[model samples]
Target chain A: MKSYFVLIFVAVFMPVAMLAYSIVPKRLRGYVLLVFSYAFLMIMSGRPVVYLVAATLITYVTGLTMGHFQARRDAQLAEVKKGKKAIKEACKRTNRWVMVAGILLNLGMLFALNYLGFFAQVGSGLLSLFGIDKTFEPPLWIAPMGISFYTLMAVSYLVDVYRETVKPDRNLGRLALYLSFFPHIMEGPIARYSEIAQGTWEGNPINRQNLYTGFMRIAVGFAKKLIVADRLNLFVDPVFDDFSLVNGGIIALAAVLYTIQLYCDFSGCMDVAIGLGCIFNVSYPENFRQPFFSLTTSEFWQRWHITLGSWFKDYVYYPVSLSKRVKRLTTMARKRFGNKYGPLLVSSIALFCVWFLNGLWHGAGSQYLFFGMYYFVLIWLGGLIDPLARSLATKYGIDRDSKPYRLMRRVRTLLFVFVGELFFRANDLPSGLAMFKRIFTHFSLETILNGKIFNIGMDPADFIIAGIFIALVFARDYAYEHDHNLLAMISGKNAVIRWAAWIAIVMAVVIFGAYGHGYIPVDPMYAQF
Target chain B: MRDQIIEILEDINPDADYETCTTLIDDRYLDSLSMVSLVAELEDTFDITIPAVEVTANNFNSVDAITKLVERLVEEDED
Candidate 1:
């Protein structure tokens, strides 16, 4: 598998790497980059070259239609510039067709790649009742690599262009590169065209400073991934894979470990990506934001997956809220339903759309969808009671921003996030729900102490190491939030202290990092995006 | 129309823009999210729907510009 990945990586990355180093025109560089990104992606999907062709075609057509729409509008606007308002009404209609077409094209790939199997299952199940099954399975089930990540990027790109947040790329090649940039092709921090357009198109040179930073980050990431996260998984997988064999205490610990494993694995991938981008002289947005330190799930969102969370908030939630239909509904609700439930009913629809898409982005499964809605319901409920919470705090003469309230909120958010991850980590939907129910049913602490799954590997010392790691996480989060400048401050101290901090982080990974033989190499979870 | 638009702009960004339109939407003085919120509030305050097309810089450039756009939209709806 490692060799296969190496072969695929060389096949996909070597050309792009060369292009990055090539003295060719910067703008045309995006063309080579786009071709290789998709080609590499298709080749990685093995024999499913058709899926790649289909996604590329869909995205290509969508961008062309969008650009065409923009051009037509520019022409009409110029004609109107000569002071002719007579045919402007017709121009508006034409522009609307373009917007509709853009949306259709962007959404077309989403349905084709992600939802086809889901709809088939539902349709076949419905048909079976009448013995009218029509079989539909495309033989090339090698699932389009990076379909989920790039699809969102494409949708947001078109949406951004339509909204004029950014200009419509007239060149289809630049647009394709924006969608399929290889380092970001698989799991992404989901770069927006607006964010990277100037940097990606203009150019940044590869300096030793950037090179060292990139490699250092990759090393740190690999350490977190191999030594810290994967090693801990030896204890976690059994507890989660078959919870029937474990007790509540064990399950609870597994949930927390899974959280750590996910963070290490995911943020580690971001480190690698950001590092890779560093080598290319582009800076991608940081996805994880010391999430555990968040005072509310809302705040947690602001910290964790900041790009994706904001993407939904900006494109979906805010737009739906301001839409004419929603405003009208809100007005009607306000007059009839009063302030009591007016905003709730109106925002719930918008919130549900964001959450539903959020869930579906994780996987092509109901469980992931449930995981997203899980936070949606929790956050919405929290939002609903905000006024009441403030008033109650006032009556009690307590500060809402005080440490205690913040601590309580943080605890609440952690619990909320943890429960959502429980569902997300489960093998399947039913198993996830059943495992959840087992939390209430089979309550015992003995399983954790008895080492039910330690037979797989992991010692008492490993648990302690995990605990120490978790503590370090919290400490680092607090420092980050408070802007402790601990490292900078300490580096100012005796050289002994500064170098010690560096050595500690490095040596810990070197000695304890999980790698080599009988160990499952866990890929970055976010990479599946 | 100028005064009404000024009132809305004041609510969103009070420190600047008492004169010519400031390209409020295009300049992104109010970010996309906050701009949407502002739009919803303005529609409620002034009784109009900012059409998707009307959301461009040609109309939303400044207080006076937005006020004129809103008046035009409202008049068209009334018709």
Candidate 2:
């Protein structure tokens, strides 16, 4: 019941849902999905389901209102050739206000639920800083599960409609279903309306190929979550929870392991979500693309949690960077600083907004803020030095595209990611800083070499098992990086080979999955976000 | 107009072969900053506003696409 990874979910809930979906007529299958989606949300978050309903209603009304204005504009334009521009502008103005109000109302609900306490504390701290003796108790509110994910989808839906990229759906059920689809409602690939709305609403019969592919993918997810991510939690959690007990070497190892744990846990969940989507004939966008292979922090963002990044890019980056005022500033700066740095200056301003929110979007914690700013600074610095780096490479007769150079860049990017994730995983900002300080100030080879590492929750056997699975994952990612599709290759094989592959994965999870005695099952980490 | 757009693109990023290359944004030949500059140059050169919605890959992915977008925007402006 906690997540799709649970045995009851896999064995009972999914099978029942799939059975119900299949039994229903095709015309009614979409309704089946909607009913199940709402049931899932209600089971997960209870009364907070009202938040989702409110958001859906607001988004639906906003989209329809925008559509109405757009229709009016077109009609007015046809009638008046002389002042058509004025009419168009007037309609655009009205739609823009409607869109803004819609966005703010949804965001305002999200802010009240997820961020009110955090911001209240921040405001109180500012008051005390100014010698005013005022403190407010932070309110405790139960946010709807997947509120963050669904709210973003709702905003994107409204924005897309306002932009005239997609027509407003008159079917309230379809819009609600898109926002509340069970598989991605917990932790999303954050699908856009334009991308998967129709296919999801179609409720196509679960085809044979899709069933096989979806099951195979879900099995891979189980193997990853059970084998690698959960096993590492034994070591990662202890070190992070009580970092002062360990030396710097252990702290550093914890950082790397936590980063791996996060990737496996989150991306494993994505595999399950996307796989479930496949079974239902809905194609969710990918959330990760071998992010460790990225050569820069910017590229890293593009590869990791790709939907969130693109959301910010389309909704935040483009709008802010290309706004009339910013454009005027860019023009003036380009005239002064030239093409290379002028737009960079303005883009950095927008990037700051993207990262700042990106961080807060993860949580209201200051560490999340630091995590966002860490990438913002690194990406900005990367852009700032890019021309210089290129010129230097040219001067030294070095090919940036050469294998060695690219490898080096990837390694550097990975290191930067590890540090960023270290802050991300820390208990809080100060603890994160303290652990980071330990890495350099108190690091000791003796701790790792003296077998002290084994005493911290994970034994030698645990390490070996986790390492083997991690290597398997790396090989899978490696093949994917080179454009080789492992699933496709397996699928293309004869039935015997495919079944064997599938059985092997299921068995791997059964044997190696970290569960039962002496182990605590970690919740899907991103679900907390 | 096509030549002018190509000239603007080349000025932004000379490495691309604007004549036939069509995946400028997809391939990231014109990265975000370059796109910003390209939009500014196109607007300045053609006296057409390049709205953020119009800055999609389909509009800026190729010289022909950019020319088409610019021409349409120009006509809209005149209208």
Candidate 3:
């Protein structure tokens, strides 16, 4: 199930159609792109094509209806501006039902599809009380690939349109393309209308620069996926699969390895999406900026899943922070409890809920819930108590910004991130909690040096590979962070050198990548999004 | 208007000043989160809807740049 051919077909066709879209008349661009989107969906889904079509239809109808309503409102607003003033709120009230309906329809489809397992258990429990002990499970749990993803796109579009941040797409065809942009259908950087409405449907000619960059990026992404992510998975699978046999030392090592693997896996897919966007000459936000180099959990979050964080901030944090209740609570806390601690305390509770919600967004499990709260607690405690530590350090006359303090903070941050990730990577809450216990109580350094983990599925050679790759990753970041012109340096070289470097990168993937080695090639994890 | 914009910028990024901070969007001095807040503030302060097209790097470069951008957008609406 490579599903590889769909990508091959798509790589050839998408940009050509986009070029065709550029020359096409205004009326047909939307329709042509829409057909392409559906065709793209059909090829990817192969056997179960109807679900994506239905999703596309649902979004199309909702967008059209929203557009229709928006057109009516705009007309009304224009009239009012033309001396036929009427209260807009009354008109808004009249159309509010449709908006509410659109939100529910999109959200309902998402939960029903993604959370079928959760509902099945609940349904089974309710029936068991009356002796209906038998269970009902879906014969096919074929969640439309990217159902979660497209569902988010639909919601974001509907919500943005409702907020009038963007006007609804009057044409249904453009709306379908927006919902089912093939590159982003499975995993996402979840482009907003404001991000891409101009280029995505604006009928821009696909330029060579965009095409070259796009495939180059996709090539890099494929290399990361087949080489780095799958290669690392060889080390992680055996360790997690048999936790009892592995010592705490190996478990910790595995967690650290898995953490990087997860990042590489997730970010590698993002490169694919961004590359796809590049081909279309549409800009998608960069979702990863070397997250492994992040110095703190908060910094790690800012770098990792950048879009998800921003999404939560926009959709959840701003609204909650601006709400009258939160505002009043903060104001009162500042006034009554003193400005130093009060508002900070109240915001943490809100922050906790937001993190917890963010965690649960990944999946519906107690483990995710714990993963969310773990951040809530750590970030909260860090915010509230960090000042005291800083103050004490000041009293002792140790420069807080001194190298030792910085090193300590860095170490503490790694521990915080590692432990939080322990819970995140764990199979369940109890498992996560048990792992944490073992790390603290039963920690040992001997096993790592003894090569216990290396003997599993990963060879000693794998460690050498990981070491070289990790060093390169760090060097890449160092160049980026320090603003060294590595890209320019390579490109500035003589033609032969540049070409050689490019070919070497390409050849590395063709030769050493984990695929075609008689081992099952694992898909990038973020594809589940 | 430029002074008011500068005051707002100073609240968010204290190192900012009108002349040095005008190329805000291009320089990536203000992130998207701050961009949203800046938009909200400009909307309330100027009583205008800053169209999406006006949020480009050129128009949102500095306090003076943003004020001029806002002035043009609002004037267009007035016409």
Candidate 4:
């Protein structure tokens, strides 16, 4: 059910919907997208559509209520000029209650569906530790697909309305479409209400150029998913499944491969989603910007999962950092320490909460939590070292911007990222520790030469093909990093060149892509989160 | 007011030329960290609260905008 074939079917169905949309009234086009989006959700998620609808209804009501309170407060302020403060206070209190209610309800639904079982197990484990053993068999709840994604979208939408950044969409259906757009329902760019509301409402007709670019983008996504990521997965899954059996070299190789597989899989899905949106003239935000090229763990995060990073920064980081208590803490620290250390202390506290929640957001696992802390420490250390490193560079007459220094930093960042991903992909915290120990203690060149690397699922030919595809991926990303407009460049070429390029992609996917009768489609990695 | 704002900006990051640079946020002259510090300085100096919603590039891109925001917050407090 998670196959690219189904995605291809949806791809075909969307264009057909647009063809039908062309004949309808211009105003009706938006509803076409809405109808199609819901139909897609129902078809894909089945009973979980209930969760989707419930989330939609909750946000829709919250938005409308907030808007109502805002309007009434403005009128009251205008009429009762003497008690403006009282009126504003009342309105603010009422609006805050509505917003809190909305956030809690949506987050509550997510918790019950996603985290309740994990918590129940934790509770039972705690009981056992206290010699009061209790077996709590958590309810078997069928959580909806994209609950994580849509709930965040819902929260962002409500917050945006509360802030008056954008007016609440009066039309429920358009709002519904914004929440449950099919392309984004898998793994979102977590699009903002302001970013996509008007465009989603308008649903512009499919232009010829958009169609060409969109389909091409989808082709590139398919090649990455099938030709690169899925193949790498063939190698990564087995090694990680039984890390104890593999040699250290193989395990280390597995970490790099897992990183590659994850990047391609997640960003590849983004490509498909963004490309699909383009066909309907709906543009989602970019999620990745050559993250592997980042010179620091912090920069890597900014480039990777660009939407989620910014979402946390805006909703969690900024608010917490600017809160009265944290601001007070900043002043206290500044009085005690100097300017640099005070702000750093404040930012460190905020970063702790962000990373803690970020870890919990990924999953309830200890390893996932460790993964969050791992990067937190790295980024915090990098911040602490910034001034010292600059001074050292100046004293040594070393150019920080020069190629050698930049290259060294990139390598250092990759090393940090690889170790973090190793933990992230491990089965458990203990397993992660064991494999990491093996990597340092038992690693040797003979591990690869012992003919054991090929024993994992992928053969030599698969490795060669995956290697070539990965190289091409890096090359394409490198071009993009240099600001090369690859899609536009291809489009501007002659017909033979364009057709050949498209055909080559299709042929590569068909020939080498990991699919057919025997393969079970590995669900897109970030979708489960 | 502008001179005071520039002084605060320079006190935070002496490298930034807040005198002429308009795209402080856009061009990375004042990143999120500095922006937070700037907001805190302005609030403390002007005796006004700058809400999180008003902390956008439009309100902090230049000394003029920062002065206007402080003035508006002051007017609101008086109101």
Give DockQ for candidates 1 onward, in order: 0.15, 0.64, 0.11, 0.47
Clashes of each: 5, 0, 3, 0
lDDT of each: 0.68, 0.90, 0.68, 0.84
Clashing pairs in 1: A226-A514, A227-A513, A227-A514, B21-B62, B23-B61
- TM for every model, in the order presented, reads 0.81, 0.97, 0.80, 0.94
What would you estimate as the lDDT of candidate 2? 0.90
Order of models, best DockQ first: 2, 4, 1, 3
* Candidate 4 local lDDT, A72-169, one digit each (tens): 99988878758889998898889989999999999999999988888898899999998997988879997778889999999999988888888987
Angstrom error at residue A445, model 1: 1.4
Query: Regarding TM-score, does 1 or 2 come out ahead?
Result: 2
Q: Which candidate is the best by lDDT?
A: 2
Task: Provide the lowest-lDDT 10-residue window in model 4 chain A.
Answer: A1-10
Which residue pairs clash within candidate 4?
none
- How do the residues A286-376 of candidate 2 rate in per-residue lDDT, one tens digit apiece? 9999999998888888889989988998899889899999999999998999877888888888889999999999999999999999989
List model 3 lDDT by residue over A448-515, tens digit each: 77766567777777677766765665687678767785655665677677667667766776776766
lDDT of 1 by residue, A76-111 (tens): 777655534445555545655766675676567667
